[model samples]
Target: MEKQDVTANEENDLDDVANSSTGNLVDWDGADDLAKPMNWPNTRKAKNIVVICYLTFLTPLGSTMFAPAIADVMGTFHSWDPLLASFVVSVWVLGYFFGPLFLGPCSELYGRLPVYLICNVLFMAFNIACAVAPNLSALIVFRFLAGTFGGCPITIGAGTFGDLIKPENRGKIIAVWSLGPLMGPILGPIAGGYVGQSIGWRWICWILAIASGVGAVASFICQEETYPAVLLERKVRRLKKETGNENLRTALNVDRKASHVFGRSIIRPLRMLFLSPIVGSLSLYQGFVYGYLYLLFTTFPLVFQNRYHFNTGTIGLTYLGMGVGSLIGLGVGGVVSDRLLTKLSARSGEKKPEYRLPPLIPSCFFLPIGLFWYGWAAQANAHWIVPILGTVCIGIGVNMVMMCVATYLIDAHPSFEASATAASTATRSLIGALVPLAGRSMYEKLGLGWGNSLLGFMALAMCPLPWVFWKYGERIRTSPRFQMKL
Candidate 1:
């Protein structure tokens, strides 16, 4: 009898261990799981997007908000070097290049909310530091730090949308979110020109700091953790405590050490950048477009002030052409792209990422035409409206192309959208940062006509890229050679 009783107890213990060790994985309860970000209420998602868009806007705004003040900053510092003046503006964009490399991966590994909150606070602090800096070197350093922290939103904002919205409905939200990054730079000079001319360059930094503080507060109140892995992990922890299941685990590798996950996560964007042909090609094209955009930004005040004989304040107003063009692009691109995707998907009975490329075909033409028009018009001293009209075309082209590429990247990578975006951001930003430093020299040596012609020719040459991608993207994306192991 005693032996039989001991046997029964041992069997029961073995059964409990078996139950704990196997088939104990935790996941969303079902498709309707309200805890999942995708199933979150519309109000909740809208609030999060608002906070994200606000932060994204402020960061890029910080990148160039003081651009109109660059001359003043140089004068105040007793520095006449044009390169140094450009560097002060470009260095912030350089920070955009580096910050996304690590921050995007960190959000994937740890969670989005903590990273967002922490970066927001630090962003505000560094902006304040910029406002208080005593010297040019100190101000540059502070600005770079501010930019690095400010990059958190630009890096992770799309991922948040991916968390909440289905791919079919993503284009609209992305278009709305993109307005922040696209318009912020265009509007920056407009505001900075007036502020710098009236109040002095230092006030630009002060205003940015104040705006950043408000963004930080909004983030704390509205942002929530949207990363699926993080949410599942939290649910697993609750279940483990409630049911006393020691071996319960989330589908994501919750048991892995944070360091190990982070180490792998940090390398992902680089891997995607180098190994994935789709990402590499699109990023290179995007980088070229971005380079020219900044080239224009840096040289605009010089071009308008010298050729059009405009003052600092009016020089800033010239950007309004690009601003209006961007709005049109955003509206048309968002609506058309989504409708195209849906229409194409219905015809084929399946959605393809390449559907997003249709808009790029027309946009490619817009870029070169605008570049040539603006360049020659400005060189010939045509009506100011002519060059501004050219800027409108350039604006429409840039925004549409960027929007298409961004949406395609998100769709192609699916769960890896953040890492994919980080790769693209890193490349474009590196080019964006470096291109402007040479803008002054390029226009001086080649003159506006040939300098812009050079850019126009390049744009013309690359016009076939979108068509090529639309034809072959699926094959390239599926090719083992282009696959990222991570």
Candidate 2:
């Protein structure tokens, strides 16, 4: 009888411990639960990453693939204003600025897979519309819609990385993933130059449409829901149905109304953007870099064609210098980032996000130097290779900065990686869309030497930002004033 009583007491104690651990909420079955993305087999994670990376690469490729065809587009539409031509390329990026504001939040509420699938379908449909656009107005409208849908991968990609990969192991994966956004635009103009010069600009849209269609099909087959909250919520629903218990709830669903949750989800990214010091500062720097890249894209044709007397097909080749530099940056940055993070974490006995910023400090200097070199070299009508080499430096700096900052944001935010990335993406896309409008006028008034020198000066002023953040980032991130309540 005493043994039976003791067994009962022991069982009751075990039950109490379990309840306390879970707080009566549903969650992963265990640390090794296969349903958790982080616990999935390596092969499954790699497959998902490949699909996500391809979509990211394709969307940004669409953003600039038509850039080389801009003059032809204007000629076809019979529009003479240079500003209008610039607008034609930039309006698509403007869509990028707005899409993430809603999409990121929605993904948090629903699931990553659903958002990706819906956006893929819509993106494909809009690209087809762009291919069949009857006028410049129609084309611009179609482009904006396509861009908005195309931004799905950009907004949620880092968050997905956060879902599947541990912080220590993320740098290498992120470096590989980042090649999409950085290289897509670089390769776009090259492909566009030849495509536009040979077949016509309309084919560019058709090509994107076909690629998006294929991507949509592959995503449906491969992509799975990785968001923890959504997964737990699904499990809660299943359990409730099986046990006939109305009280079953996931932690995320506890005492929360649908409307309230939806409203908060929509506002979270904006809240983080304006209220968080780290997000704002890093985003500002990223915005400047992204804007500079687009500015170069808009002006490259004018420089290469008019100054160097290159044809359309040849003008596309100039982007190769930047592309080569980006490849170099990607390779070096990936290897160094993980090794540095590991070394620093080992030495400090803690993994902090600041470890990611060290490479960024020296990399930032390359931007101004490249700008100065390219500007002065072009202004003097030096060898075409001179300006091209300058772009290589710019590419290296840009890639390293982007890779580092993105990894930092993901590491710092923990569960809120998607919103943080959305905030960053929104800021950069806005700048990217607006800054190029001034490029033509700036280059026209100041000339290449002074114009690029001016940009270089601004870049030089911001070079110390990485050091400042590395020193104080943890304090700012932890402070109540900067923390997002969501």
Candidate 3:
């Protein structure tokens, strides 16, 4: 009888071990019986995404919504120089570069939800300070702080999505996810141009605050803890309650000395920056393109207002080309990237994350072509549509390039997705912040035609980077620094 009982207990123990391991590996699918996010009805998930999208929208809108109103701000504040005014737009990006170094690590330690909520509130408060600033210096200071706070969500949003969605379906889901960030810049200047021209620049800040507040409430209700370690901890707690097994803990989280160490939190993002060549090279290339794009962004109002004789609202409407082009590019690229991945996997006889680069090759050529057209047309004062058409191409090219880089980086380094993204953001934002200050000086000295031609030349030079990278990416990724085991 004793021998029979021992065998039965051993069998039950094996079953329990199997169940625990299986639970950990089961990819999160919102529709699955055990899927936490899927447990919410379809309507609920849609609502959550919409709310998160809206929240995401406010960050970029806050970044550039004030751009169209810069002339008014200069006159109102009695500032004489345009370059100084450009700083107002570019400074936000400066925050974008630095904020992630700290915020990315902090989110990993504290969990995504708490950090997300706290930072959104801080963003709202500081943005309001920008609206009510007593002087230009104060406004600049407030804007910087607001941007630093706003930076948290952009990083956290990526992690939050991973928590909610499974890897198998994430490609399509991420396409929808791209919409929010893309739409914000489009919607921002349109509304901002009208609002700032009619009401005041302060209203731009008020509008952002209101929109962000709504997003915060929605997140509080719908956004749950998605990190697996966090989720497992909750599961352990629940099991302890149900079966009174206090020892029921996840093996993945052993609470080692390194786990509790705070120093790694500060060092890890920087370490990844130096150690990951894939992260470094991709970040550098993307950063320059992003910076050039923003440099153009800061220059747009001046080009239209002074050169084309457009009013503020009309100047804002011109950005519609950029917005429309981005949407078209995103749709086309999303389809092509997925198809390319499927085909490459079949042909290579093994899946490689580097196969994703082929779809991005066209953008390298298109970007330079668009730059030349946009630069020369705007400089020559060709009919407005010609310049807008060029800008449309630029937008499309940028969207595709961004989508490819973002997807590749995430796919290549899944274990360190947040850190990889942070590295990219750091490089991109630093360039975005610095490029605009030179716009005024460059355009003024060279005249619009040659000044823009100079920009075109730079884009033309960069055209080969994506193609070379795409062909050699497999070899490059094989290096120890980029040796992603994915």
Candidate 4:
């Protein structure tokens, strides 16, 4: 009887331990789960990235796919001034500047998927409103609103991938995703030009709405919630039910006394703008470059239409130079960035963001050289191909710089990836919005030759600035506001 009692106690002890282990497993209430995102199946993760990219592509298509219709709208609405008409072309970018201030932080509060769905619906509705707009004022307002809503994808898309992919492998995925936004301006004009001339300016809007509507449906079906905080909250809800523990909660769900109120969180970006030099410098540098690129885009039709006497259809073809150039640049930039990371990893005993700057050096030189070549060639009324080739060079340089800037920002500010990107987008949008307004007037005063040369000279001055930062970037990144060590 004594021996039997001892054996029973041993069995009971084993049962107790097992039950305790199971209980602990169910207590994910406050613990981090490695298996959450990091453990997601590779195939499922890849599919998610693809779906996100698709949703992202539709947003920009809404932004610029109406480019070819600018002239038609101006005439339809009886607007006489070209400057007034350019607003139709560039106002979307203005909205882009403002959209991120709200859309970005709100995504962090909710989740990427919810933010994406809501913004896209707004984008599509405004897009439809733009198509049927009866007057210039109404049209501009709708276009601006559409751009604000459309801002969600560009601001959040890169970070969404970061939430899913690790740093080591994210370079290639980012490279692929970057093409959609970069290529949209080029592709938009081609399709928009023909559609505007063939059908009506309104059809351009209709076409974008149809395409975006389809994308919206696909996004709703494919995109699951990706934010960790949001996902953790869901997990907490599930465990509360399973264990019947009313106290079960996640760190993300509970508001700490230390947490910022809604007002503070809302104004953080403005504070970040004034308080952070890194944000200011990067925004200025990237913004200027982006603005110059769009300035050239808005002015291209004028160059071809007036000098070469090309029809609108033919003028739109010039955008192909930009498309081809961007592809080449992105391809080269991706390869160079990855290789530099590997080399720096070996030298520093770890990867660092400084390595990403080497490819940028050559690209910087190309910017000025291409600008001068394009200006003088167009001025001399040289063969059309001369200007076309120069545009290609500009395209290559622009894409390289953009890709480098984007990757550097994301690498440096992993925790604030969304905000950093939002800052960048807002910067670019402001420049994009402002540049085209001055395009015609600038061209008239300086002529194509001098005006473009002036632009090229400006690009030359800023080209070397990136290298300065690359060398001493670590010191600058040490700022608490910027938090570069991430």
Worst 10 residues of 2 by lDDT: 9-18
Clashing pairs in 1: none
- Clashing residue pairs in candidate 2 (N, C-alpha, C atoms within 3 angstroms): none
TM-scores of the candidates in the order shown: 0.94, 0.93, 0.87, 0.89
Candidate 3 or 1, higher lDDT: 1
Predicted structure with the largest lDDT when compared to the true one: 2
Find the number of clashing residue pairs for candidate 4.
0
Q: Model 3, stretches more than 4 Å misplaced?
A: 1-47, 241-247, 254-266, 481-486
Model 1: what TM-score? 0.94
What lDDT tens digits, residue by residue, belong to model 2 across residues 1-486? 435643554444334325646545666555765667897778889889999999999998998888888998989899989998888888888888889867876787687999999999999999999999999999999999999999898888888888899888999999988899899999999999999999999999999999999999999999989988787777667656655666766765532355765566557777887888788888989999999999999899999998999888788899999899899899989999999999999999999999999999998898899999999999999999999999999999899989999999989988677778888898999999999999999999999999999999999998988999899999988888766454
Writing each residue's lDDT as its tens digit, candidate 1 over 157-264 gives: 888899899888989888888888789989999999999999988888889989999999999999999999888777667666766877777766643466765566
lDDT of each: 0.85, 0.87, 0.73, 0.74
Candidate 3 local Cα displacement, residue 347, angstroms: 3.9
Higher-ranked by lDDT: 2 or 3: 2
Please give, for residues 153-220, the per-residue lDDT of candidate 3 as tens digits. 66666666666655434555566566555667667888989999899888988988887777677778
User: In candidate 4, which residue ranges exceed 4 Å CA deviation?
Assistant: 1-35, 251-266, 479-486
